[model samples]
Target: MDQRTNRTFICSVLFIDIVECSTKPVEEQIWLKERFNALLSETIKDIAVNDRILLDTGDGAALGFLGDPEDALFVAMELRDSAMNDQRDPSLSLSIRMGINLGPVKLVKDINQQLNLIGDGINVAQRIMSFADPGKLLVSRSYYEVISCLSQEYAKLFSDEGLHADKHVRQHRIYAVGHYEFKKATIGVPVSRKTAPEPKEAPLTDQPQQGENRSIDTQASRYRKTITLLLATLPQRPFHKKWISAAIPLAILVVLFAAFALRGGKGTTENPSSPKVVTAVPRPKPSVTRVAPPDTKKTEPLRSTDPSISQPLSSKRVARIGFTLSAVERKGLDITLTVSLKNTAADARSVALYDNHYSWPKSHLTDKGGRSYEVQEVYFRKGGKRISMYDTGKTGIPINGGATVTAHLVFRKFPDSSREAVLNLHPFIYYGWRWTEHDVNFPDISLE
Candidate 1:
């Protein structure tokens, strides 16, 4: 376990790989590497050196951020923007793919006594990068889980690309950042006069099939012709009002005969031979219940038979606050949950998400067996504003009157045997000028 006595910690690693670098000529490859290094350095200059470690991978590079996970994301976005805007030379265009992962890494010294990293953290980061297309940014599910909750803006930037299987057959769920076009941009630095080779054409297999195209076109033409004939004939009446009146009387007689026929078959209707049609109806959603204070009379417990019911908690402050458990996801030892909070008051109220400065814990998860898991992080988002876990301010995020806000909470060391858990929120919400220690519990949350 002491592979490196130096230090072992979890960090967000950004892995970048230059596309098709091996096919380039010796002189062009050298120039491309130089330009990439310069751009990467410029993008990360604002980030402190002590908080990050950079590893060169010959074709590309990896950066492990030991501080906030957002640091790696910021650098990735900046590097992409800078690479796209560089205008040095037309031949020096570059295309790169990036991937980010949050995992465990060990700080070790290389043969040259230089600091190096080795672990699943950077390895998975590289795997994630390998799945990306040129000019695109992809992030592992672990990284997305942490960073997306930091802010609503960050969350909106990600679109789920679904699950992918790597070479090792390990399934990875990845999220793609905002779309990007693979365009070339040059910088001001002078380079060799050699012109870059043109991109190769797509393989024949990627092209559309001629037979399939012809079939589709024929079907479309027939549909268009049929529609044109109908449109051309609609204006001409097939028969006048006199014909319509005669046809209506015959139609009513036919309807009357059919009604009489059905009435004569009432005996058969009592036990029809035809099968019955069963319509599927959706189940009603569970209602949100307000948690009463201890002094208040005890309420009836929810019927334990229904799995769809969720017992939520609430506050009885001047503005009633209610919570509805939205989603719960468990991956390995981590547990992530989203709770929707609604405020019924007329004005916005400040609610503390988490306060590190306070002595007591703000929230946690407990199982039926009484095992408790500590809350690792919390993020609160309301409208366009977001509150990060690292915020130092005492006042928490504000929930507008009658507005609903979402709170994402992450817990570590989840109990493996527990299929149901309870989330307890304590002393975080403000009732008036002072902080209220009233305990709120959301019970019987299904973890399966």
Candidate 2:
């Protein structure tokens, strides 16, 4: 096979390692690797083949993401969840550690003319993984700085773990990954186009990932082009010049005629001969009406369709639309609430509950102690695809008039001391190009 020249690029790399594969027996080791490979494939199935490069490392593997940086975080979260949640074959369960870094990597052909990755990017990723505990994921400071600034949701997923020194005495700062449902972060933020630094012998090109060449023209660009085109065609259109010269006098006459007609055809009504009379109308003084606050402490019988779910109060409609509390479940540090949106309108309306790219009226949980918990993720079905709210490719979900749609909202686990909580939900209904916010507060919700 013909070998291609080596190329260096700036990208994000993920390094994973089995906890103790070498200590296991040969049969168990084979089973472990097989299970790991299968899980990894499922985790990264949604990503494109060309956007990522995988290199087998015997026990674990290294993944280089040539696309978005958040791709690495998603894969890591999914892999960790799958490994810990696998209940089958308790004796041979797998545990792995992961690390992510954003740095420069060199792609070259190995002895067999196959693609291989070698550089400080992969090396630092391995070092970061070493600092992680079993079934944990850690990331270097470089990766954290770039990703955290992208969106508020991404920033909430990381916490600084301080700096650690490696064997070579080189210090590296790392951040521990917090527990979160696997959801896509907003990718609208612009990244630097700088490339990896190269040696004196070979220089790397200053460009980012491919497919970025197809940027769409903005409104400003189109307006500027239209103005330039009009200027270039003005001199060639002799008829337009003559038309403008003749239209000036015609426009003046039309303005004078409209002015004369506007005065009831009396002509110069403001003159001394026809003095105008002005009367002042007094405006009514503004009156203030005081509204009583809602009784949050008032409790009603538990109303729920499912016995496992508990609703302390009756659910009310927001914006003439109703939401039925279908289910509420708690597992570990996660709480999932399911609801169905009922539309009573005669026509279809587009609805948007959540999105990371744009800030909207949010839904959250507040305990009796006044502790608030923000929503971690939202799930719904659109066009037969399960989507994360605000992370969907489309702008909103469409529901026909008199139709209903079911959605699930995942929130951080409630504290044990807080046996009851209140939920504030904000959902937006789309009106052509505009959005209208309809908020509902469900108080006295039993968490126990």
Candidate 3:
């Protein structure tokens, strides 16, 4: 064999780890460890060959790249999807927290003359991974800036993303990874140059998985399958709600036409313009209370005999979307709130749209009988102008009990202030599949 020589290169490094080891039987524990290591080794080897210009540092490897941040970023993201697929066990999940940095990397000769890497690029990539959440990847500002200059496609992607001031790292921006679900997007980033040929992007990230979802679409393939699965898996109770995709808008049109007809009483008598508040019916918010928590101390449903334990609610709700008070410790630009709704009204074809006001209702359970001890502090806005959602005392929707259905705000930002320890929910019914209302605020309640 020819003598191998150590080389120097700039590459992106990815770190894969086996986190949260379980205390199952020794055989079972060994099984998980072997599964992780085998998969991790294969992924690392693949990156070196195809995504060359990349590096791995064992549990996680920092990849160095000869290309711009765009190339490195793209490489890291693709690798992430690859790792996830190669490691098929979502429970006792085989995952990697990748960090990409565009810096100097070196391949030095080892005792057996194989190769080993060392440098700032390695250190920085490790740091970026440290700040990343599980199943997420992050990069340094320098990497981002480089990506911006290389491709406008990445620029637009980063600009629309929710960036976080690193939780532990000081003074740097770490964009959250959960925000990147390519499969859910109908229109994706246009990562092409005006003069150059476009590069091919990968398959959608929202691809189907086991457990209530699959790669194959069923007879009921909805555009918002992700949302459907999310709501299905989310902790929810049997609250009555109706699906209003068509009727709500019809109601609005009816009201608009009525106003026009009222003022068009040509000649015989002139129509007088006056406040219509007296005739306007007050509308209720399109709110959704999450399904009550799963009952403990009973035979847990959704049987899984894989020999692993159930994860806490955090992994379920916090990782994705759920009804949470503004007080949740959200990272990035701010927490993005998405409301999902259903309507169950019988008489009214659809529900009416109303002003959405946010309130935090504080409650604690002294006992498990379900009667929550609540200090429900309700209001929106801080300053001198206090906007109270409960001004009428009942801030809940009767929704005709069994007849009313539901809707929610999809593109909402966390209100400036959120009520502390509030339970239940408040969903805003809106016009688009995308619903979200920003700049809503909540303040701490005064305990008198």
RMSD of each: 26.4, 24.4, 25.4
lDDT of 1 by residue, 16-129 (tens): 988888799988888889989999987788678777888999989999887667778768876876677777888678888899999888888888777788899999999888
Q: What is the lDDT of candidate 1?
A: 0.64
Per-residue lDDT tens digits for candidate 2, residues 188-213, read: 32111111122121111223234332
lDDT of each: 0.64, 0.66, 0.38
Positional deviation of residue 144's Cα in model 3 after best superposition, in angstroms: 1.2
Best by TM-score: 2
User: For model 1, where is the 10-residue window of minimal lDDT?
Assistant: 184-193
| Candidate 2: pairs in clash | 355-390
Question: Which is the better candidate, 1 or 2, if ranked by lDDT?
Answer: 2
Candidate ordering by lDDT (highest first): 2, 1, 3
Kindly report which residue stretches of model 1 are placed more than 4 angstroms away from their true locations once superposed. 1-5, 179-448
Clashes of 3: 59
